[model samples]
Target chain A: MIVQTALLIGLVLFSVLAILLRDLLKSAISLAAASLFLGIIFFRMNAPYAGVFEISVVAGLITVLFILTIALTKAGDEVRESRVVNWVFPLFFIAFIIIDALVMKGLLRKIPALASGAETGTFGDVLWKGRTFDLVGQIAVILAGVFAVLALFRKGDKHD
Target chain B: MIILFVALPLVVAGILPLVGKVSRRVVPDLLANAALLFLLVYAAITGRHLIAGGPVLQQLSWFGEPVAIRLALDGFSLLMLLAIALVGLAACLFSIDYMEHYGAKANYYALFLVMIAGMNGLVLATDLFNVYLFMEVAAVASYALVAFGLGRDELEAAFKYLLLSVVATAFILISVAVIFGMTGSLDFAAVAKALQELNAGAAVGVASAFFLMGFGLKAALIPFHAWLPDAHPSAPAPISAVLSGLLIKVSGVYAMTRIFLNVFGLTPALSTVLMSLGALSMVVAAFLALGQKDMKRMLAYSSISQVGYVVLGIGIGTPLGIAGGLFHLFNHALAKGLLFLTSGSVQQATGTRDLDEMGGLAKRMPITAATNLVGALSIAGVPPLNGFWSKLIIIIALVQSGHPVFAVIAVLTSVLTLWYYLLMQRKAFFGKLNEKWAAVKEAPFWMTAATVFLALLCVGIGILFSSTVTTWIQPAADVLADGVHAVIGSWGF
Candidate 1:
């Protein structure tokens, strides 16, 4: 329980720091850190698959993308300070969360219970049976990416 | 099978690069044209079947349980597919010669086919998750197509489109996640049933708002129209035609109307909101279009304006209104596609896209001039053109529905459309010869052929408006007019 609480607090702290950081590169790193903490929290809650995706995709791949963009653009630190969080807003947010949690607890009692094994499905079955068209969509997206990169990096007359 | 509508293009897209390398001209062009022709013929047969009151559902299953992906053949999806196939065919024809200037014809055709597959999937999808996924597919292809030239302007426009589209997708995914959390299902029928049981509280309201905003961005409605003027004009002409003529309708207007009318029965509040958005896009984009010096940019803005008429018509929630909106959808596709192709021809010959630099091109490029005149008159709502009947229907529907103020605004916007199009004509094709383009020949035969085909459609559909409406549009509108419960019943889920 104590470790779970620490992970939760780390998630909140890194998320805020990510937004508050002036340098975009540092902000990206902070965001990755927050994603890592969230992944730990998910694993603690028995969702290993979700945790794995969060760590690999959000924390790993996305951080590399952000770093590449920063390097290519040669961007400097943002001049303006972030005003995303303030004292009154946090207090109101905390109060709203409390009320929402209580209301959700009441609502949960009214919902039907899950059937046996209803919450689980094999990955292949879930993707093939549940999202056939999405697979087609993913194929299109990957092909588009391939062609887009080819078009962008083609060797030819540099005429604009 | 409905799957063939999506699969044919994809399979061809997968094989195009290999074939293009061998014979860039013959192999790729023939295969692309053949694929599109097959899809068009298939769409026609299925649309006729649906029009004659045929079967509405086509299910594909794997092992034991039925798959979540369902493809529906309703009147509405049939009409949309027909529009997509027709526009895609015309654009493909135009691109045969137009894409030669930019090498790698194979890559271009490959991406184009993928985009068509994505749109076809989007229209036929029966689940919310598939809708979002197909929307992403279409969006991704379009971003690349917009930047295909790799020029400075093209890259900038593509990046802007990409950033905004990502934001829109995020919003849509959030809404989808919320609905899935509440309902434990992704299929449209299942979600509707669950929401019905749950009494559809604040969560549904929030999701609906997100849907409107997200789809609104894709539609390039007034508030989220920043990327269109840049991106549409920056892409090659055929891509511009496809993007303005078909993509927005499939990914934005069609998705929004289907979800609102079929999934979450339309309330007065949602109807009013839709109408207001339509009105705002109509007036604002018209004014913005009026001052544009670039030819394609003006047409892009005009698309947002025409889409307004459609949204306004559907928002009225009457049968006449919905039919009028749908009719406008078909007519606008032909007229706008024709105009963009004509602009491409002029640009190809004159080496410029600025309207200010063009003059009296009729003497040099008669085919382009004549076809462009037809397209311009059609879009400007001349009495003999298709745009006239659709606008008249929408305006009359507005008046009949007791929204006289919107009717007046619609009329004023029509006049504004006419004024700008006439200005474009006078500047580009009617005045004294520019002398620089005196030796410019008419666009190549295929380009002229494509433009002329769509031009004839603009006039033909106008003259045959009644038959066209009865045969094509009314059945689609009937699907929307039936409301949510009837739609769910018809799905037989």
Candidate 2:
């Protein structure tokens, strides 16, 4: 449990750095890594299916898409816009408020209660018996996604 | 039979390109329209009931436990299906000639049909995950359609749309994951049942925020509307018609309404959030639209504004409000579809989408001019048109619910809606014929036919609204009014 908390803290720190990083590619990779760590935490919490899906879908597929978009757009050189100091004060103020709320909300206490006696069947049991329609819907979404990407990337058509 | 509403479209959409490959030019157009017509007929016959004693459980067993992939049709789904089918048939018919300018007729039809299939699947989906999948299907096709022109602007707009949409999907997926974590169920009925068992708090608040942002983006509400003005106008005219007429409503607004109302139960805070967002989009988009010179761009903004009305009405969470909202949805689809198609016709004849570039086009394209006028007046809430009735109902409901301020805002926005629409009319259609467009003829027979059909339907529905309400609008409203409890009760889970 100590190690898990440490890993989560590390992930949160890395994710903040990632968002502020100079290199887009490095940011993407760092974000993916953070997602991986978060997935691991989910697994430690006994949500193996969600953990796996998180690593595979969010970290793997979406990260690849982001990279492809970055590559396609030729955005290698980072645009370092000057930051507004005024913005930072409010941003940190909001962040502190959120942090305070998080600590006071008893969320940590609730997590263990949720973890106890949670369903432990394979991903199929929850997906089919509990949420089968979502799977079918996801398939439909993937089909649309694939087609849209194909249309954008289609070659040798110069009718514009 | 319920499944066929989705399956028939999927099968036909898949086979359409191949069929087009074999047939003569006219056959593909006829077949596509005929297919939608058949689906429309099928839905009408099936009416509002769930397919009784049908295969309620079809477990593929591939993913592990026998997960039943279910599709159920109810009044709300049926109404939306009918709307998609009706408008889709008209768009397909109009495209027969409009698409002649573009060379890839087969591919265009294929994408169009696939989008229809996705929308059908979305409306009929009883499960939350299925909603995501179907939403993607529609979203992806829309992205491709937006970029179909392959112009620099088209590519730019499509990319922006794709980026924002991906973010929205990610938000929705995360919410779905959280909901599954909370309830251990993905089916809408099952999720609602489980949610009732759990206490509402921060976790649910987080989930609701995810849904709000995700679906809000899809619906193009105020803060999330940056992509819409570009994306909607960038598409080819038929595709624009579809985007404005149906896409945003189905994937964005409809899905949000279904999930929030039927699945998660609309709490006071959420309803307030929806209403405020709706009001913001309505006022802001209308004001922004009033300053635009591009005719289609202005209309695109107007679409966002009108959608605000629908959302606001639904957000009120009264039976009358929901009914009014759904009624407005139907009317907006017709009016907006007609307007977009007519704009396409105008663009084709004049070779520009700029309102400033057009003058006195009414003389040359009389059919388009008349229909565009009808659409404009209808949208602007002129008396006896469909828009006025729906807007009136919404205002009445608002006043009845003791929200006089919102009712006043709704009224004021109707005038604002008129201001931009009239500005659009004066600049594009009402002035003297431009010398450069002296040779411009009316849009071809089919496009004119489609525009006229929708225009007439707009009037017909307005005049015969009482019967239409009794038959269609009331049932759909009842579904939403029944709320989360009725939905779970219906399943007998």
Candidate 3:
């Protein structure tokens, strides 16, 4: 529990750092760290499938993509100060605090218990049998990701 | 198996890249077309059985016990599958010629096939989480397809689409998570049954709001519609056709309707909210389309307006209303897809999408001109066209449901739709031939063939309107009207 709390704090700090960092590369790295923390939390919560996906896809693949995008564009060293964000952050922070408090106090109690179905199945059984279509969808999405990358980076088209 | 509807294209999409590496460009094209054709043929063969079979529920199992990955097919999902297969086939055929210049033909076909797979999964998904996942699959593929051209405008539009879509997906995830937390299962039937017993009005209400925001953004309804105009017009024309014609209806309107009507019983308040959004999108988008100079952009705005008519029909929540909505759904797929493809041909032939830059190409590109005219007049609600019947039904439904003002607005919007489409026709096709495009010939044979096929469907469905409603459309409406419990009972889950 202590480790989970520490991981949660690390997630928040890394996320804030990702947003506030001016250097694009550092921001990308911070975002990856945040993803890593999130994956750990998912694992702690007993959702290994979600945690593995979060680590592999978001922390590993997406972070690599972000770093590559930054490097390919030679944008990592460029940093610009944003007066607008400084002005906006406090208001957002306050709003978030208020919503969090309302949820913790009044709104949280309304949540109902989980609805267990009539049948129970193993995790693999649930995924393969109950959610087969989603697996197909995920494969399509991965293929789309590959094609999108190829389309963006491939050369020799006159339309370019 | 019921899973074949989603699995077939997916399996084909997975192999397309490897096949492309070995063969010429046409290989991917032929293979993708074959896959879509197979699905279309399969749908045609089995559609009757599904509708007659009452509800086809196939559960994946382990240890001889039913498992969570279940697929449910009723009349509604069958109609949607048929629509996806048909429109996807037309888009693929059109892309064969149109995508020749885009380069990376194999990659484009891969993305396109993936999109078809996603839509098929989305429509057939029996669980809330699967719907969300399939929606993302379709959404991500479409985002990449939007940016496929890699032009300045395409990238900008894609970035905007991605950002807004992420927001929408975040909302959808929150709602799904909230529901799962409240009702231990993500299965649609289980949640619906559990929700019925729980005194969770406030929670359901908030989730409904999130769903409306999410799906409304997907559908490009009036208030949440900032991204669609730019995104739709910026993609390759076939992608634009698929986006406007099928994606929004399936992911946005269809998913939203299923959730609101079936999972959450459609209360009067929800009905009012949906009807209001529909009316707003219908009238507002038509007015916006009037002043657009770009041909595809104008058609994009018109899609939003036409979608309003569908939403209005569905929001009325009457049998006639849903029937009208479903009819309009299929009609829009045929007609609007035809219009986008025609615009693409015009753009391909003349090298411009600006209506003002295009004039009197009728002589040079007779097939395109004729097909464009068919699409325009059909969309304008001309008598004996499918659009006319659907719009009339929706308006009549509004009146019968005692919302005379909305009915009046519906009639006015139909006229408004006609005014702009006629404006588009006059400016682009009916004028004296632009000397610049005098040398432009009809689009390549395949493009013309695809457009003509959709055009024929527009005309044929209109002519055979009653038969279509009875066989294809009405059963879908009956499924919606029967509510969640009846559907669940039919599945015997």
Candidate 4:
């Protein structure tokens, strides 16, 4: 319980820092650290597949992508963000914590511990048989992302 | 196969860019339009027959073995599928001419098809997790489409939209996680049954709140509406049409209504929340719309106001209310789609979206002006137009349900709606010819044809409202009227 609590706190802290930080590189690294903490938590919870994916894709692969993109591009003129987000976020965060402290414990306790169903299978089985539709959705998302990149970065023609 | 609704578009989208290199215009246009036409025919002609017996479930067997690719189509989903295909075909047709100035027609068509496939998949999905997944699929496609023009304003709008949308999806993911932990299943039928057995009200309430906030952002309800006015007007015209007319309805309203009414069973509190949000958006957005100089921006605000009416009727939780809400949803989709396409025509011809700068465009582009009038009148609830019937039904439903105050609000909002629409019409289309637009010409064949088609439907459906309601709206409303039993009983595999 102690270790899990510490991991979760680390996750939340890094995530908060990620949003608050103004520097893109620092923000990206903070996000990576948050993902690392989350990946560890997933591992401790006995979800090896989720843990592996979280660590590899989000923490490792995505972080590298973010950093590489940052390296490739030069910073433009400094852009000032809205002042509203500064206070609003922290206010909402503190209020959510209060609600969590007051209500979530009891609320969570009342929920029944349902037995695991199709998830109690091998990773291949789970991916292919238990959740085939998700694969189709993932494919669509990737296709959209790729096409978006192509369309956004295409040679300026008549649009010129 | 019901999978065709999703798979056909995806397959076509996958090959479109490759096909584009061989023949940029003709081949890609024909292919994309053909794909959408096929889906439209399938949904309009064959869908009702398939579901005549009951909800039909598709469990595919690949290589003679069963897979977990489960999809279901009932009255509710079929209605949404038909709407997507019809509006998708219209917008795609509009794009053929309108997008000629913008390059990469093939890639644009591909992303559009992907977005359609995502919405179809979302409606057909029978599980909570799939809902989130497909929602993201559609969302990713839209973010790109919004920024496809790659201008500074377009890029900024897309970025803001993307940021807010990520927050929305995060809330949804957390809610889904909580629900899965509570019920040990993501399937709609299983979760509905489990939730009933558990009766864990507070946890369920938390999940419901998250889902409400998330879908509310997608729908651009009152408090969460900051991103929409910018995003809708920034995109290319066909995209603007699809975004306002169809995307928000599918991702925001359809998803929320299905989850709340069917899987979770709408409580009195939830119903009240829905109604309050609806009324607030109705009054507020209409007022905001009255002040806009930008034509598409005004239409965008009006989209929010009309969506409010749909939600208000649905929130009444009566069968008549559901039917009214749905009929209005369909009406708004057609009318708004036409209005946006015509606005695109005006924009393309005049090189501006500011209503103040436009005048007597009727002389140059009579077809566009006339179609714009039909659409504006229809949406403003003028007589013998489809929007009138739907709005009247909603107002009547509110009064019948003893919500006289809300009924009055609905009526007043309709009047306010009429005022702004007339303002838009007069400023842009009715006045004496402005010398600036003296050289403007009618929109190309495809763009005019698409707008004409939707205008005719608005008039036709208005005249034939009763039969249309009996055939399409009743079945969908019946499903929601069944509430939790709709899924817990009939949807079980």
Tens-digit lDDT string for candidate 4 (B283-335): 99999999999999999999999999999999999999999999999999999
Cα lDDT tens digits for candidate 1, B410-463: 999999999999989888988799989879999998898899889988989889
iRMSD, per candidate, in listed order = 4.0, 3.9, 2.6, 1.6
Local distance difference test values of all predictions, in order: 0.86, 0.82, 0.87, 0.93
Q: List model 1's recovered fraction of native interface contacts, to 2 decimals.
A: 0.46
Collision count of model 4: 0
Q: Comparing only chain A of model 1 with the true chain A, what is the TM-score?
A: 0.61
Q: What does candidate 2's lDDT look like per residue over B3-74, in tens digits?
A: 666667666666665776687357778777888889888776666444333213333454485446566666
Estimate candidate 4's alpha-carbon lDDT, on a 0 to 1 scale.
0.93
Which DockQ values do the candidates obtain, in the order shown? 0.35, 0.31, 0.55, 0.70
Candidate 3 chain B minimal-lDDT segment of 10 residues: B484-493
Could you give the fnat of all candidates in order? 0.46, 0.36, 0.74, 0.86
Q: Please identify model 4 stretches exceeding 4 Å from their true place.
A: A74-100, A114-119
lDDT, candidate 3, at A146: 82
lDDT for position B492 in model 2: 36
Q: Return the candidate ranking by TM-score, descending.
A: 4, 3, 1, 2
Error of 3 at B399 (Å): 0.8
lDDT of 3 at B246: 98
Summarize candidate 4's per-residue lDDT along A32-74 as a digit string, tens digits.
Answer: 9999999999888889889999999999999999999988894
What residue runs in model 1 are displaced by over 4 Å at the alpha carbon?
A1-28, A41-47, A61-118, A157-160, B62-68
**lDDT assessment of candidate 3:** 0.87
What CAPRI-style quality would you assign to candidate 2?
acceptable
